[model samples]
Structure formats: structure tokens, C-alpha cells
Target chain A: MTSLVADIGGTNTRVALAEGPGLMPDTVRRYRNADHADLTDVLTDYLREAGSPEIAGACAALAGPVRHGRGRLTNLDWTIEEAAIARVSGTPRVKLLNDLAAQGHALDQLAPEALVPVLDGPAQPGATRLVIGIGTGFNAAAVHALPGGLMVGEAEAGQVSLPVADAEALSLAQFLAGADGFAAVEEALSGRGLGRLYDWASAGAGRPGATDARAVMAALDTDPEALRAAETFVRLLGTVAGDLALQHLPYGGIYLIGGMARAVTPHAGPMGFAGTFRRKGRFSALMAEFRVSTVIDDFAALTGCASFLARTE
Target chain B: MTSLVADIGGTNTRVALAEGPGLMPDTVRRYRNADHADLTDVLTDYLREAGSPEIAGACAALAGPVRHGRGRLTNLDWTIEEAAIARVSGTPRVKLLNDLAAQGHALDQLAPEALVPVLDGPAQPGATRLVIGIGTGFNAAAVHALPGGLMVGEAEAGQVSLPVADAEALSLAQFLAGADGFAAVEEALSGRGLGRLYDWASAGAGRPGATDARAVMAALDTDPEALRAAETFVRLLGTVAGDLALQHLPYGGIYLIGGMARAVTPHAGPMGFAGTFRRKGRFSALMAEFRVSTVIDDFAALTGCASFLARTE
Candidate 1:
């Protein structure tokens, strides 16, 4: 019995077919999401190219919340439904899970090359694992290892209002608040958020010329305003990540995923990310016990999606 | 086969006998914790009063973190270990769990009368539930409903740095930098936190006369400074609670359990706790979907301990 799996993101749709447990990909395909009207069209194309093999079950990693068998992408205009996809792919049973949840399910299947350890901790088996992604957007989730495998849960923590501790509050109000007022943490911590931070720092430093995140990073090479902005961005990101680690008590350690984490790897050390993460006062000792690492592999989520379909089926 | 269960808090220790699914209070006893040196003393008294019934298994809910089969009370000097308790009680096996974790395991056994709904949501089965406590200390945990019962995991989220949005940050800094220099969120939000808020507000408003949470609440009956401070405390608490709800995605609902929750029930409404909770920008609609409620019963954790021991045995 073969199972078909798909991971749909804002920019691309990844499709693959699995035959059985620990099975190699029979057919792997990718489609530019902009070219397709919806997931059904891309899935249809995958099925046609793969000769429309009979699939016993199907699972998809969607970039949005799954409720009542349907998910609307946060970054894209695509609305994915299990019934619609099942009909298109001719699969009897289908499951839709958040992409991060699928990433969590795939944690156990990662190869040595797939993982890049950021910190080391007590390697106790069956402990809770916290997975965080700092890519196109910022979000995190924790996976508790049950008797058989792992139970993954949702974390929309990125959307929570950013915490401006003491000195940072002054900077945040001066740099973040706009005419309509500052948005949540994601407004300055996400990929798009970096640009906003850059703009705010530039304006605060009396340089009304700075614009996007790229411009800010480039200016950091020379301009103090850009450097200050970048520094704040990295520091706050680290603080929040540490905050999440404490909130979840991720004894299994913390895994940083997505493109932004990779980009911030160099700054993770110098920008005081580690320092801020470990500064939880009395719980600081407990915080030091956790391991923090960044996952630099782009294909990790795809591999995770494949692993998820295999284990559940 | 009967099991013994105990919920040990700073002020009280509740001991009960679980014959099967129900609790035997005639076999149960409550003791003022201050009267006893440690848990063993209380357990011995309870067992002696109950005719020293042979216990098959024993589980205890401690108002502190459980680590390496031992627990240290957060507010007290008491430290207990499973081995010592097992030896004293003649129980072959003993399990110690965080009070919040134990409360989570007892979710299924709770009767309708046991819960008082503060916010309502869809009755979706199999969804994850979040349990939060804001009393002497603050903490949160998520309970994943598994087959036959619930699986609970501990979260030290309370220790996570409090998010000080805009105005709150200024007030917090003013409060912290004053005479005490206290930085903990629990310093201002717990039973003691309200008092600190009042002190800061009074000082900030140039009135050094008002002190204590109760005094501040009374002053708020007429004083604008006291009212604003009280409102800020509730709003900050609500924001943090909402953040936890989002972080856990407690689609099943958010259960507020602890002494502070009860203390602030009346003020929670007027202080914009609900409004701050539901103000998550794009995710506000999703936040509105969660059911929020305060656990009014003092014996909720005790009942939970009883239910947990019964099921495990």
C-alpha cells in the first residue's frame, strides 16, 4: 500500500510517494505555487506525472491551521481541503497537519546531515522536544514523546505581543510604534519584521533614508543606526526563543528551523542571543541545561513530511 | 486494591484513599502543613487515622517542580523524595508530579459542577486543553487527551520573562528601580504582585502613603492612580494569559486555576482582561474561539490528585 504526501508552502508545493515504512521516494516532484490555482491543480499534476498510482492514504503539511478538514494558507491564497485533495488524488483517507507539526513528527527521522546542533544538553530519551522555525515567519511548537511516538501541538506564540523589558521598552516604543501603532512581536521579529525594525531604527537614529531588512543588514556593515537595529533584532529574537524554551520546559532541547535562523547564525553569538536566552534570573540555571541549535537544511521539512506519512500509515 | 493520594501545598496537605473511581473522605484527612515537619509526618498521621490500610500504589501532587524522584516546595523548606515516602507509608511504588501536572491528569474525572466557565467555546472532542495557575507562583501546562485519559506536560512559562508592552514597561521599570529593584513578573502579578503594583503607582503618582494589594484595591474605589495601577495589572495578566493560550493553541479551552485567579475575578472584567486576551490582531478571531474559565473550587487540585491516583492504579 503506497501513501502520497504533499507539503504545501507559500511559494512551492512538494509532492512525493511512499511505498512502506522507511521507504525511499518513488516519485518526487515540486511545483511553483504561483503557477497553480490551488493545491488540487498541483496535486493533479503530480499524480499525472507519477502515472496516477493508487494511493491508500494521503497526508499534507499545510502552512496554516487545519480545522474541519480544511486549511487556508497564511502566506498564500490557497484553501486546501482533505475531501478536495482526496478526490483529486483518488486517495481514500487523508490527514492535514500544520507544517510545523509535521516537522515535529519527522524529528526522529532526521539524518546526521539534516540536523545542525546549536547547543548540547542531557540526552534523555522520551523527553519533550521543542521545534522552532525563524524563516518567512516566526513560530514554534513542542512535541511530547508518547509511548509509541510523538504528539505535536500548535504554538502561535509569535503572534503574541512582544515583551519589551525595561530598557528595550523605551527603544521599542520609539522604534516600533507608528501612526496606527506597532503590531505584535512578529512585526519586528519575522522576515518582514526585520525590515520594519530597520525602518524604525533608521528613523530613530535620524536617518529617514533606511527602508527594508536587506538595506538595514547592509547598512550594519558601516552605519551605527543599522547595526543598533540589527543588534536589537537578534537580542530580542534570542530572548523570545529562550522565553519559549522556558514556557515549554523543552527538556529535549530546542531546534531552530527556517531560513532566518540560518541567516542569523553568525549574529546568534555576537548579538547576545545566547546571553539573553540564558538570563531568566533564578531559572537561569535551568535555562543553561537546555541545548539550542539551528537547522540549516532546506530539505529538512520535506524529509520530515515524508517521515511523518510513513510512521502514521 | 486501593491507592493513597496526597496533594501537598504550602498551607495545607490533603490526603485521600481511592478504593476505585471515587474518593473515600472518611478515609481522607486534611492537615495544616505548618503543623508537620515534612510530607512523611503528614502521611503517617493520615495512614494512622485511616487504620493503616495497605496501599497498592501512591501518587502525590506537590506544589513545586518534581525532579529526579524528589520535590522541593517552592514557598517552604520541605523537600520530599519518593523513596522516603514509600518507606514511611509502606507503599511499594510512589510517584510525585507537579501540582499543575496532576491537575491536568484529573481533567477527565472533573464533574460539570467542578468547572465554572468564564469564557465558552465549541465543544470539540480530542482537542488539547491548557491549565494555568496564578497563585503564590505562576505556571502553565498542556494536557493532550489520549485514549482513555489525558497526558499532561509541565511548562515553566510563568518564569519566562513577562512581556511588558508600551506603558506597562515604563511602570514596571519605575516599580523595579525604586526601593526593591525586583524584576520578577510574579513580584507584581501574584497575591504580592498586586501590592507591588500599588506601591509603584502610589510612588509614581507622588503619594507614598498607599501600600499592599488590598489597600490598593480599596484606594481604587476612588483614587485614579490606584485604579489605573490595578487595571494595568489585570491587563498585563490577561495579555500573558492570552499569550499562553496562543502558545498552547488550547482549542479545547484555557482553564485558569489558582488563588490569584479567584482574587481578581471581579477586577478581571472591569480591567480589560478579556479585551486584552482577545486583542491578538489577525489571530484575535482564533483567540475568541477559546473557552476561558477560572477554577473556583479550592479542592480542584485535591480532587484531581484523587482521580489521578485512581486511574493510574
Candidate 2:
């Protein structure tokens, strides 16, 4: 019998079967959430396709709040419950974790090849590490390195107020405040945040047009507005990263997870990301000593789910 | 045998002998650090006054950075070493903690009466709590409530860039930036912070006077400048507290410790502290659910030291 681990997002789901901490290479499968009515339906389909093998235990990671043994998809009108998963998947034991929390567990299992270095500072063994996810949404977690094991402190950090510093940023803040009455960190850091920045810049340049984050990023080289928007996005990411580094003092390093990480990493080198991060007055020296990396492995969450189940067992 | 607990600050030191978590009320003694040469001298004097009873273990909380069983007092020309304390106090075991870390442990030990509630929300039993100390120096810690126990995460949060809003705050930020090249949270939140706010406001009103925090506070009723300074201090405290609450997501509550908490709490009610804290746009409703309290007990660090020693043992 093998443990089944799954990461369920709003539009897609990744399922895998493994016996231990690492995900089984060939046993991983992806499914469209819209093709199924609920998580149980998708789990059942995946099991049947895999010849309905006996399951020892199961762990599921979702991009939403997990409380009372249940989680509701942030974008989809669906809820996954531990009892329902256990009954459908034929497992007596079931575990659920926040997507970012699962990503936090993946820190130890990530291979050197799976990471792209942003800052190569001296990292201490068994030091606390911080993980930040800037995807369609924003969230963070601190993985405490203890003598016994790692303890992850999950957070809804995107809900925090936005930290603005310049005239352009102040204008964006005013625009956000005008629309929502308060500007949250997520308003300037998420996928939609990129789009917002693009629109704001385009409007300021007197060439206003509606566009998504991808379209804006694609036009970065050709469109001055897009380039400006991208720069602002990179700078804002740096600012938030600096704030989190201070709040957590994660001397071990900071790991940026999720899709948007790739976009943020290229701009976070010696005097780009790390520069804005370390410009915090007297503590700049201490902040300079923190390492930063982007998790390039797409299957990290699956490996993390497997690790979580094994640890719980 | 009783464990000896001592909280050593730059100017004062409180020593006590306790058997467990709670302090031995009458056994507590306060001493002037200036009267002694170093921590060893203070420890030796305290041991002698306490009749030199058989010592079990000792935990000392000093206002400094503790690493490798050594600590340096931030405001004093002294360093405390575990070996030195163990040698002088005749104790086989000695533990040293950062003053704020010691306070983090006191969260669980504080009595209901010792907490002056600023926000009364439904706190989760095993949720995370944040402790912020705004004394001579500023720092904070996040206490994660785990299934097994509480894990305290230490922070040098004062060094992070300050978060500012409003014209007055923007003006203050500009002033701080001109002076220090960067605006850190501690520049506007500590004891000297009150004085800085008063000075800035007075300068703006063309009634400039160089006054310390104590003098400004004493002139609050009759002096308009002092009143404005006091108001700004309270509002800044709230803003910082709110930012911290978001950063840590301390749904369990936010506890204000040290000498400055009492002064800040009186102005933290509906339209004061709590109001500013719950003004975070869309997350305002959620922020309203966080409990805020001022720790009134002066012996909290002593009690915390006792708790830490007991837990480790």
C-alpha cells in the first residue's frame, strides 16, 4: 500500500502516490478540476486510472483556508473534507494542509538543481527559513528549524497593508484606496497586482488599455508602460520581501514559491532585489547576510504532501 | 531548591528565587545595575542576600543579544556569560535569554488581572501570539502555539522600515529620512520616539522646544505641543501594532509589554488604538477580531525566565 498525495488548485489538481517523503517519479498525474464535480470525483477518477490500488493514507494540499478538517477552494465553489476524502480514497488516515504550508515543508526536500539563487549569503544550519508565494494571490510561512524537527508558522500575509515609498507608488496607493478604501499588500504583489500596475502606468502614459499580467509581461521589451510596470512590480516585491525578512529574521534564507517567483527572481540580484531588501538602515548589514532562492520545482508541493503525511504517521 | 531568575536591564536589575512558573512574591528584589560592576557582581550580591540557599538552576534575562551562552547589555558596558554566572552564583546550570524572548515566554504565565485588554476578541486556544516591547530599545517576538508547546520566534523588528500614512506622518517620515537616510519603525515608536514626535510637531507649529519624553508627557494637559505629541505617539503605536498584527496574523492576540505599554493602552480604545488597528481596508473586519492587551506586571520577565528554565528542564 502506498500513500496518496494531492495538491488541489482552483482549476487543476496534481495527484501522486508515494511510499515515503519523495514523490514517486512515474506515479504523478494531473487533472482538471472543472472536469470533475468535486475533489472526491477527481480523486476517484485518478484512483481508477491507476487500477484502484489500495491506499495506506492520503494528504491533500489546497489553495485555501483549512479549518475543522475541511478546506474551501478560494476560486471554486467546492469544499474538500477529511471525512469525505478518507471514505472515497479508502484510507483511514487523512491530512490536509495549506498550499504554502506544504511548500514550507518542501524546503528540506528541494534538490540544489531545483533552486535558483537570488542571494548567496552565509546560511546557518538549522536556522529559520521564510517562504513567500506570489501567484494569483499572496501568502507566507516561516519554517522554524528546531532540534527535533521543523515547525511551520502559516500566515495570511497578503492581507497586510501595502508599504509604499515613492510618488508613483503613492498615486497607486491613492487609486487602490479610492477603489477599495484601503490598500493591502496583495494589491501590489499578486497576478492581478501586475495588471493593476500595468493599467496605472499605461494610463499615466496616456495610452490606457486593459491587459492581463501575461500580456503586459510579454510586451515588456516593446512597451515602455509595461517596462515601467514590471520595474515597479519588482521593486514592490523587494520592499515586501525586506519587510518579511525583518518581521521573521529568517537568517536561514527566504524561498520564493509559486509562478510569479520566476518573474521576481531575475530582478533580485546583487543591487536589485537584494539591494532594496538590505537598505533598512543599521540592520542593512544583518539583512545582507540572508540568502534568497526561488523554488523551480513544480512538483514540490506533491513531495511536501507526501512528507507531511509521513511525518504525521 | 529554588531557581534564581534575574531580569537585568541597562539601569536596573530585578532578582528573584522561585520554585516554578510563578514568582515568589516576597522573595523578589530590585537592584541598581550602576551600583555593581557587572552581571556577576549583581548575581553574587543577590545570592548573598537570599541567604545563599541551595540553588537549583538560574535563568537570567538581560537586555541584549544572547548567543553561545553570552549576552551584552545594550545600554550598559557589560557582557553576561553563563559560565561566569554559574561560577559566581555557584549554580551548575545557567540559561540566558534576550529580554524580549524572556517576555515571550511570559504570555502563558500572565494572570487575567495583569492584562489590560485593548481588544476583547475570541482567541483560539492554541493560536499564535505576538509580544512587542517598546522600552529604551524596541524589539518583538512571535510565539507559535503548537500541539506540543509554544515556540518563541525572536525578532529585531524595530529595524524594519517604518509604515506611515497621513500628512503629519508623511512629514515625520520626510524628517526621519532626512536625518537617518531611512525611516525605521523604532524611530517613531520607542521612548525617545515620543520626544521626536513632540519635537517634530512643535517645530511644525513654530513653538520648538527641546524636551524629553518624560517632560513632554508631564506637560500633556497644559501644553498643546505635548498633547499633540501624545496623540501622535498613540496613533503611531496603533499603526505599528496593526502592521505587526497583519505581519504575524496573531489572531490569538497582541500583547504590549515593557514600560511604554501602559502609556499607549489608554489611548487604544474604539476611536484610538483599536480604531487605527482595525482600519486596514478590506481586512479591517478581520483585524477587529484580534485581541490587544498591555502587560501591567513589572515582574513579567522574571516569571518568564522561570517558565523558560522549567520548560527546558
Candidate 3:
């Protein structure tokens, strides 16, 4: 029997039917969450749209913290639970995975072209891999291929205090900390992080700062301050990514996902992302052995849900 | 039949027989590694002394990296493989685990008294756990109790660049970096780390530095600089531990092991380790939810070997 897979995000929810790990792309449909009362309502409408297809199991990737098969959306007022999903989707065996875990499961399923290589390292077939997400927020997950199924490890990595190596970096961290007196990894690596970097760079360089991440990236080729911010952001991202690589040792590869990762991919190679990533003291040599890339697939979480159900079902 | 288990260190190796996860205390014997030619010799001698009891499975914990079921001891000139151990122990099933992974496996088997609670947090049953080793070297492992068995995630975390938050901490990182100009986590967290912190503190106060870590801890009672160093060491350890807790989200508990951990345990509470640990800005509340403790068992690795073989066999 086919399985139902859905990726529920803050603004939109995408649902699809899956035959094992492979999804029926033609059946894929996106619906604004704002139009629905809750996840149950969304799933009900989607099932009706799909002609009430029979399903054996279902899995949903939610943008929130999951505990005991239940998850709550960070930006949406919805408590998504496995029981509710199973009730609506007509399956008892269902799974609710956090967004980052979904990304981790999607690693092996992504097309080769969707993973744009920014740094060189061999991706060992069955080895563990790390998926780092840098969108409106930052988070990470580790994927392990076990005998039973693929196990994705959880992380609130975005909330960890930011790492600063030099005087300039410390100054930037201080600038980011401001009244809070603490700067987390997300404070300098997510979408708004670029704008924060620009603000700090401009403040230091005696220039006007960009209004947002879009404006700063738009001025990358024209404005010197924006260029400096992009370079600094890329290097900081590399350093943080490098530290994570060492912590996880994801021999398969390190997949960078989310809005900020794709936005910075074109300039990462030139801005010395790999250079800063490889600056881990005596472990610098070991750093060169990791493959870092950006995930370009917008529907990765959906694929992840399909893959999750495939392995479990 | 009993299982054979051993923990191989640089200077000493502890060998024992196990009935499932429980180690036979009387069977446990410590051997000076310099006396034995290799692991096979030690195992052979131990078996001879025990009247050659048959072992259905065998597991050994090695103080080095393990790749493809083979391991090389960092401080000893030895190569250990599953097949080699199988031949030596007369068991076809043999597993070689890195020392940190072994510690990760030892978590559940550890005596309640052995785990002295350094910080208060609920240890959720069947949840993920973290084992952080800061002995002569620093390293950590994340333990997941999956369906198949306990899967310990590998880490070369000690080799990562040191993180700094403030001016004083940045100065300490700089001083620790020295000529290498790059200070890793091990540089500021392991056994030698206390000495480096003391050196930095002493040098800052225009006082004499200690000969080693032992001297610094010994001076903690009367010397203000030594106390300062200890305070810094404990606080830094907490910060790193807190960061790791976020990275792994090890709701089960965070177990601290090794010589450094024990030496600093008495001072950890008084020195504000928990205070620094919960300093993760907006996520401080989340940090308070993690249980941090010290694993005091001297033969934890040996117990880990037994536990691993018990689950697999």
C-alpha cells in the first residue's frame, strides 16, 4: 500500500503520496497553512483532493521540536501529533520527525545535481552524514545508516553560544550579543545573520548598513561593505561548519540546507569558505577530507518524510 | 560461555570475563602493557591463568581510532582487528570500539554511586545520552538507544578549535594557542588544560606558573591564582559541556569521565560550572533541562566492552 507524506512548515504545507521511498511527484500539492485550522484539517483537505487514496502508513516533517511522537510548530499555533496524523491519514504506524531530521533522511535521496559542491571530499557510500540547516534559523542533524533503518540524531545546535577565534570575530560577537550579552550560532549564520553582519561591518567601516539580508546580498557585487559582510559571513559559516564536522565526523558528507546556504553557495568558493573551514589547528589536514555542499532541493523535507516511512514501513 | 573483554591503554590493560553485561570482578586483572608483547599475548596469558574458559564473543576497548572494525592504539604500537581478536579469544564475534564509544556503552551499567550528580536535570528513561572524556586528551561520544542496540556516534571533538566568549576567555585562548596560534578544545579542557589555564592566570597576575596540573590543583587551597585557574577551568568545561548538550540534545544525561573530570568535580559546584553551563542566552532554560554528571568508575571501558558484546552476542 502507498504511504502519505507531508512537510508542514510555518507558512505552507506540502503533501504527496509515496510508493516506498519514491514519491508520486504529480500528486504533490502545496497548501497555505493559514487557510487551514490545524494539521488535521490540512490533511483532510489534501486526502479529499487526492481522491481518498488508501495508505498503509504516513510520516510528517514538522518545523518544531518533537517529543514522544508529538511536535509543535515554532511559528504556527498547532500541536502536530502522530495519532492525529494517523487518524486523518488512515494509518496506525506513523512518524513525526523534526524538520532537521527530515533533512537528514533526505540526504541520500537528493539528486546529485541538487547538491552543489562548494568544497571537495569523497562521500563514502554507507558512512554517517551531517545535515546543517541555515534558513531563518540554524539547526543540525546527524544521519546514520543502521541495520534496521536510518536513525537521525536530534539537535538544538542553533542555540549554542557562538564561537569566536580572533579579535575581529570577538568584536563582531560582542556587537551581535548587545543587550542579551550572549550570541548563539544562529545569531550570525541564519538569514537575518547576514544583515547583522552587514550592520556590524558598516558600523565598523563608517558606512550605512543594509535593511535586510536580501539588500545586503543584492549589493554583494557593488557595495564594498556588503562584500565585506558576505566574505565575513562565508568565513564564519565555514568555521562553524568545520567545528561541527569535527564534532560529528560525517564521513559521507556535510550537506548545507536552507535559504542562507543556497544564497551563499555561489560566492562560498571565492570568499574562502573552505579556507576558513580548514583552519582547525593540527586538525586542519583532517578538515580537508570533508565534503561540504549546499542542498538546492526545495522539496527535501517531503522527500525525507517519504524516505522515513519507506525505511520504517 | 563467558565473554572476554579488555580495555587497552598506553601503560596498562585491564582484562576480564563477563556474564552478559556484568563483569566478573575477580576475573578482572590489570597488566602493565610494557611487559606484554601485544594484545594477543595479554589475552593469551589472561586465558591461561583462568584455565582457558571458552568465550562465545569478545570485545576490546582501544585508546585510538577505529575504522572498519580495526583499531590502532595511539600510545602503543599495536593494531587490533576483529578477526585478530577472534583468533586470540577463540570467538568469531569480536568488536573493537574506540575508548570514548566504550565509555558511551558503559553508561547504563555504571553504578549509581559512580555517577556523582554534578548538575540537576531529569534523566529521561530510554532517551539519548552523551559521554564526554577529558583525560590526558579530550573527546566525546553520543549514545543512542535505538531498536537494534546502543549506537554510539563518534567524535574527534578534542581537535576542534577552542571557543571564546569574552575578553578574558579570548586572552586565555590566545595564550593557550601559543606558537601554534591555534588552540583546540583539548588544549583548554583536558589534564594539561588545567596547567595551561593556571599558566595564563599566573602570567596575567605576574605570578609564577605551576610545574603541571597536579601542582595547580594542590595549590588551590592557599593560592589565589590556582583557585582562579580552577574556577576558570570548571566554568570553561561547563560552557563546552553546555554547547555539546545543545548539539546532541542528550536528554538522558551528560556523563563526564577521565582524570580531569574527577580532579575538578569537587570544585565544579562551588566554581559555578552549572551557572556557566546555563549561560546560553535565550536557551538557558533549555540548558537547565540537561543532566550533567561525572562517571567515576575506573574500569568503565572494560564494563563498556562487556555491555557491547552482551547486546550484540
Candidate with top lDDT is 3
Quality of model 2 by C-alpha lDDT: 0.82
RMSD in angstroms, candidate 1?
Answer: 2.8
Top candidate by TM-score: 2
For candidate 3, what is the lDDT?
A: 0.88
- Candidate 3 docks at the CAPRI level of medium
Give the per-residue lDDT digits (tens) of candidate 1, residues A1-313. Answer: 6777888888988888876534345466789999998998998888888888888878888877887889989889988998997898787678888888877877776666766666566745678888887767788888888876678878787787676666654577446544424347777777777777777766776777546666767677888877887888888887788888878788887888876677777777788887778777677778777888777655555566666666666
Please provide TM-scores, in order, for all candidate models, with all chains considered together. Answer: 0.92, 0.97, 0.96
Q: List the residue pairs that clash in candidate 3.
A: none
- TM-score of the B chain in model 2? 0.96
Least accurate 10 contiguous residues by lDDT in model 3 chain A = A176-185
Residue range B1-313, candidate 2, lDDT tens digits: 5898999988899999988777797989888988988878887888898888888889999887888999988789988889988887677789999988888888899889999988888777678888999887678888887655668887788877666554456678766663335678887788888788888888999986778878877887799988887887787777778878877878778889877677767756632776667778877777876888889999899999998888767
Clashes of each: 4, 1, 0
The TM-score that candidate 2 achieves is 0.97
How does candidate 1 fare on TM-score? Answer: 0.92
